[model samples]
Target chain A: MSREVILGDIREIMADVFDMDVDDVVVTPDTTADDIEEWDSLSHIRLIVAVERRFKVKFTNAEIERLRRVGDLVALVEAKQPA
Target chain B: MLKSLSWLRPAPGDFRDQARALRSEMRGGRGDDLGMRLYALANHALDENQLVSLARLAAGACDAGAAPAPFSAVKLGVFGDGTLSLIAPAIAGTALRHRLAVDTFVGEFNRAALDALDPSGPVRSAGLDMALIVSDARVLGLDRPAASRAAADETVERAFGQVRRTVEGLRPSIGSAILVQTVAAPLEPLFGSYDRIEPGSPLSMTAAFNRRVADWAADGGVVLVDVAHLAECVGLEAWDDPGQWHAAKLGFAPSLLPVYADVVARAMAAVRGLSRKCLVLDLDNTLWGGVVGDDGLGGIVIGQGSATGEAHLAVQRMALALRARGVVLAVCSKNEEAAARAPFREHPDMLLREDHIAVFQANWTDKAANLRAIAETLNIGVDALVLLDDNPAERMQVRSELPLVGVPELPDDPALFPRMLAAAGYFEAVSVSKEDRARAEMYQANARRAAALSASADVGAYLASLEMACAIGPVSEMTRARVAQLVNKSNQFNLTTRRWSEGELAAAIRDPARHVAQVRLVDRFGDNGVIAVLIADKGPDAWAIDTWLMSCRVLGRRVEEACLAHLAGAARAAGARALIGRYIPSPRNAIVKDHYRNLGFALEDESGGATTWRLDLDRFVAPALEMTVADGFLAPENAAA
Candidate 1:
């Protein structure tokens, strides 16, 4: 799957978590925790769990901590996908 | 609890197809995994309304044609110190299995637990079945003075005193049960890790406090959840993020919420009395090493000498231990009845006997039919059964045939069987009542009654010939646990099946405005201990039956008639002008559709499927019971309701 496709799925998950439409989310490499209305500490954890379960991937604490934007999560998921 | 998750059956789908199929199901419906885990990824991420809707849709879709009312939600109150509000929604969402919905009351941040339990406390009227508390030195502001042993001791003692007082102050209304996490050891050093005296540390004091709480859990109303051990398991670095702690006062990191939710959900299930009641075992390779028919008694590997024999012996001993603690044991083997029972009777090393089994089916029939027959003979739903079989194919077949039967995966090695079964936690019991101790023998008596019924010409004559009698009275402490168990576990014969916890039952038994009784039946065969319970709300001139359920074993025996007669008399004696009963329709309780009408009660109202009936005390008379009554009997005319 392409990174855009993975990002689309992650956006859908984010939209569900925030109770918004998928199209309402506009993401870029710089879009981050402070940019989103619903992205808080607890929500960040839930988003990780949802994305990990969706992609059948596991993330390290360090990798999750390093993530600051949607692009970072998409890259981590793409890297962790089974080759 | 993995029911027909046929959607997840490794089909000819690629990874995307499988994921799409699962997502489609969740998008359009619920993904019922029988709560072994949360249904879908969306559940953890979505808010309460979305998650609960997905749960309900999935549950309705899973059980087709059986539109039972959505089960009542469990109410929980989370009262603690620190930033706990952020995690309440996650806990509530994670606990939503198909049959259970959890609603949480998150107390204000950093509120004291003792203050919450006060008379006008914020959580006083929540009426929670479970209350979760997270208290520690950091939450209580127990700062130390100049790093001395005396200061550490005083800090630990004060925190312990506060928590103990909070636990004592908690006046749990009726069904409320409290769960309190012990203090987590402070992993951080006061100043530096170097040259630290461990004995004078706060970590040592926290450990000391946890030990006392562990001892207190043995007799107190509070159940201790081992947060300190959980922190250790999660590892110190992941468990405590220094940045998050400093920023948000978070006790544990958000990443560990799933693990926390899993532990708490299981503890809640244990207290809610949702546990399996039967172990249906296949005799051939499951009980012994080889096929009973082909190998014969001596050839089977269940004797004292061989390693395989010892493995089989271990399984038998575990089954016997479970039976002793109220799990009914039965055998379903595909062989001649005599041939199957030969090892049980003849082998010197066999720990389980034919008497140990309440129902034994040894025929060439399919295993599913035999299991169904076993459940029917035992008068229980297939949901209450757990089957053990060594053969994977047989287990799969039974699973397909009866989705409700819990089939645990058995290891290839026979030696791992005992511990694997133990770790499954199938027979989790909150309290072992006196009636539970004699369950095995009582089932044996049931077998004799079955035999008597089969031999008699007519059912009524058989019932009359048995000289059966029942003793009904107020719920005493001796019978309170079993009464609550029956009220929770009984589904089919239950009219208005209401679940009451032991604390709730204890309170009801003492209230003069309420009427509660447990019925014990004794026949010529043996005594069936506390087979039924009935509760009613008593008013000035009217008494309404809140719940009435009888064991299915005595279903056709007119024991309910006798019970109603006794109720009418009691209502009249209490100056009640009328006795009323309600029949709320559920799929299982359809067997009791015309119960009140047949007993001469006039129909009062009917809405949707729920029906109410009333009996005027002036015209009602006690039904003439053939069996002698031991206690709680009124004279014939006194039973006027």
Candidate 2:
């Protein structure tokens, strides 16, 4: 999967989690939890659970902690994608 | 519980769509109107994300003051050593499904012991109706391996002691019912295959600790959450999450939070006396494989010979087991009464016989009305009935019409029917006593008496035809538990509606100034064990009835008349001039609102929906009834014989 496609999937998930329209949610490579109002610690875990489930991948604790932005999640999903 | 039943159908697309619509409504203005829908979605086997979404919507609806009226608001205290921020919403959401609006006070994380011990803690001072202590293996030290068998036993004892102390401390501080969870054993096992035999292993120690907890809870009258059993149902690996625990100290997997909340809610419901009493089953495709009306008895698939037949047999077996544990069984099928009775009467392989059914209503009428009629005939609230039907249309109709009635969605497979019902936890009971074992047979006999009554020309002749025998005596050690059960459970036929613990009953029995009557009745059909309990106080002038409640099964049988006559005779013998009776109205027990008036007591005082009645012993005429009466409850001659 391409980075744009992974980012698009993440956007859809964030929209659902945040209860927003897909068009209303805009995620860029530098978009971080600080950029989203609804993205708190609890919602952060919810997002991880949803993302891992959607991509059929598991994230390591250290890797999940290291994630700083939407781009990091997108890259992690891309790397974990089955080739 | 719903998620554990893998045999159940995946949440239908329409259900998800409906849930989405309701969720969107929460964001919009009309979220309050969606309380019942949100409750229904919580009961469905939805994934964790959907559950969380629905929970948010339900909380919003409740906050908007649009919670349904059938729910009883409960102030719940959830004290856990792990992260409980996520769990409170899950509990509040799942509790709505059980008809409870839970306002939870989440205790400080890693301070379960301290919070429970602190008399002035926020959780204890919140005036909680029930406290749920969520214990995990990490906090209980069940995740630690012991070096020897003695060490394992010590670990188990220490864990149980800590839990017992916590419960005891909370008891004095909160004065609310306490529920504790059994720590789930860690999935990672040492000694591999030998783990089962190794007493010192962490798994074995956890198992031992759980056993100790169960015994202690039984002795202390505490409710066990049984999370270990729940974890086993959905394999331990799935139940526990290393990633979540490592990151946030989440005790269990966040995905399993919904199931955990469901289990705790069921235990709370049982504590609050909201457990369902009856399992109303459909005949065709529910109790058996094939349609009994369409297919002949021989053609129907139910028995030992085939796999399909065995699957159907499993449903009947589960129903019988529930009946044995005091859950009344009834039949409400969309078939002719005779056609429905045929399998139970004629099928050699059928496990549920006619004697096991309390109220069998098999007809062309809509199942919703039949369920209402069944509840009426059984003298229970419609909410107490759970209809298990394979036909989705029938289930949907019942759900829409009677939202209080439990209608579990049945899987297409007949084999999964029993598991689906079990997973629903509709007939969850805190404890079963001796009277529960005979509950089904007594209801069946009551049904037979109802039939006999309709056949007879006169009410007097009908009651006479019952060949009824009455026994009245003081509450003894033999009848204390049963009396307490009736005192707490009987609502419709209860006057005063005073709930007394067994300890209180024993004290009343011992007090010389008080008279406790343990009334049991037997007809030619069967023994209706301890049908009525009356506690009266012996005053200077009259005998005042403190609590009077009879089983509704014996209603219209003139059992109350006989009890009054016995009380009058005893009062006169004790030189009392009159008898005083009080009727305190409750949400239930309205059936007996005019109980004293109908029984010839003159109204003396009326206030606040409660009335006091007085009967002159000098003028009291003992109405002659056509039944034998034994003074000591059980005749010594009969016992000797």
Candidate 3:
């Protein structure tokens, strides 16, 4: 329900998708696709899909392509499901 | 796996939440695991609305060219007069259930009618197996039908003629199947006071169009995709989106894509020949009101006199209708054979007799084994059988042991049996010929031959004893339906599995350059009817057999040799140097793998798993047989009758 809670959920979903530990994955506004070892164009799509599925929201193709960092994804998900 | 399996077991709210999650993920991207997502969507947990929404998203993803769905590709072209791209994803979603990765070519809006038909277009170059005509741009806006039946007739006939021309114009390179959607009745509230939304108005015109199309499509490989029926399943209002229509010029609403996709999926499935050929039914409580053996024959309600009896009667009538359309019906019950046979013999209300059944297994054996035996006796694959039993345990047993076999659960009430079976769409046949109607009788003749074979010394002697007669002639109206049905349905003895519809059969019959012959056999046992079909293309110097197929019952009876002998004569008459025949082997039809060689056809060439054989017309000799041949064009069925 809160921003932090939603971010926490996003972390768990990303961990499952990338097969990494939630603790090993760090989130910040500067955390771009370059920051994640496994992140690429294909995996970026998968990550966006994973986040959308976990949060019950949709990201336009333009929005997905323009996403610059994990913080953008977190902010978008929080904005999508406001309390 | 457990998560998907348990997704449907949750309560309403929980199921909704789970379905939403899966659908959202499925739509977001990553077309991988589409098969699983489709499975989850198919579960009963999701309501119709939820399923439709998910299907729409899936269709969108497909439109954008989603991942190659780790599936066997089924290429298709969706062309229409209006916005047709919205439907691509839903079709892709539904095709996933069949394990078909759909690669779609969306025609330019308003050019669906002309795109595939233009011989030099990209659609023709796609090498598609099938194509769908999404909608006619003017169907909804066509002049409303007047009160008179004649007005309605004129409306539909005009539309049908235009559509027919488009269908017939489809180039040979457009692939094998052309799927046309029957125009749906428009949503209520047509503008203008005279445009009264009455049944005999535009609604009647659309319905009449569908009826005529269905009649015309019976023999033609042209399939009428019943989008109107899908519209009926969901409310007509829900199926249409005028807002989007006015805004995007979308001929169809985006919301209805899921339902429309379903219709496309079914049509595609039938075209690919991915359908069952037989329905194995269980007796006891399934076919009658009670257990026949324990309750005695009279106690089992199956007559037209009582309420419960009528329910069982409906199931029997449905079976009889299916049988009439060439869907084989067999009985698999857990009871004594005598007890089962007694009901058919004694009950006056029994719609199905022992003659109607292709196989009757009424032993206490495991039903799974019984179902398999039925399939084996029929020489069809296990995947081509649908078993219906009242007992849940029996359904579960068949489901677990024979997963390939379809086990459709009937409602608790026996009256719903007919409705349930009809809705399952398991026996979705593409075409039915007079031969199809006589299929049960042909199977009976085979049984008689089997009996005679056991009594005779050898197979050759048994064949010789039976006074077999072969009618070799050009295909006639009476025989065209049977010939096309054979071409479409016969896989085991077919040389090259090329399916032809009735329209093509007529075209071939009229073409002088193509020599087509249909063979009908009748022996001592019974009338075998039209059991074989042969089509050959007349080249300048050679006549090549484009298609050669025979009923399994007539195999090993020298039927193919006799046909070839007659073809050689015809070729010689046409001033051709030789007759050509080729064998393209498949999962079935291995019986005829060496048929060309056995018929004295020299191996002309072999390439790419297909073997081509040639027979010099001048030196070819007909196989001697104790039979009579009715040569030349046989009269149509009606004329003969």
The model with the greatest lDDT is 2
Model 3 over residues B431-532: C-alpha lDDT tens digits? 655666776666656755766777999877888898898888777777777676668768788999887767778998799889888888889877888778
Q: Under the 3 Å rule for N, CA and C atoms, how many clashes does model 3 have?
A: 3
- Interface C-alpha RMSD per candidate, 1 decimal: 6.8, 2.2, 10.9
Tens-digit per-residue lDDT, B1-641, candidate 2 = 35443423355566545766776776687544466666666666655556556666666566533355456567777776667777887788778778777877877534655665677776567777777877888888878789988888888888888777766666654434678888888888798878889998888888888888888677635778899998888788888898898888888877787678888888888766789988888888888878878888877888998888999899889988989888899999999888899999999999999888889899999999999888877767898888888898997798889888888776677877777788878877766778887777776776677677778999988878889998888777767877887887786789987877566678888999998888888899898888998899998799999999998878888889889998988888788999999999865678999999999999999999999999999888988888888776335344200
Which residue ranges in model 1 land beyond 4 Å of their true spot? A1-40, A46-66, A70-83, B1-72, B77-98, B103-109, B112-130, B134-177, B181-263, B498-508, B585-589, B632-641
| Candidate ordering by TM-score (highest first) | 2, 1, 3
Error of 2 at B578 (Å): 6.9
Backbone clash pairs for candidate 1 read B30-B58
Chain A (candidate 2) TM-score to true chain A: 0.94
Could you tell me how far off, in angstroms, the CA of residue B505 lies in candidate 3 after the best superposition?
4.6
Candidate 1 per-residue C-alpha lDDT over B1-641 given as tens digits, one digit per residue, 9 for 90 to 100: 11111111222323223333554565664544523223323222233324423433434333333322333356777766656755566565545432345666776533445555566766676666677776755764443332666776666677777776665555453244677777656666665553145545666667666777777665435677777776775576667755556645667765566456545655665565456778998888778899878887778899688999899898999999999888899998889999999988988889998889999999989989999988888777776788888878887788778765767677778887876576445676555677777877777677777777889998778988889878777666656667877887677788887777667788887898899877888888788878788899998888999999988878887889878877888888788999999999864689888999999999999999999999998998776776876545343232211
| DockQ of each candidate, alpha-carbon based | 0.21, 0.43, 0.06
Among residues 3 or more apart in sequence or in different chains, the pairs in candidate 3 whose N, CA or C atoms overlap within 3 Å are: B59-B89, B59-B90, B219-B502
Number of backbone-clashing residue pairs for each candidate, in the order shown: 1, 0, 3
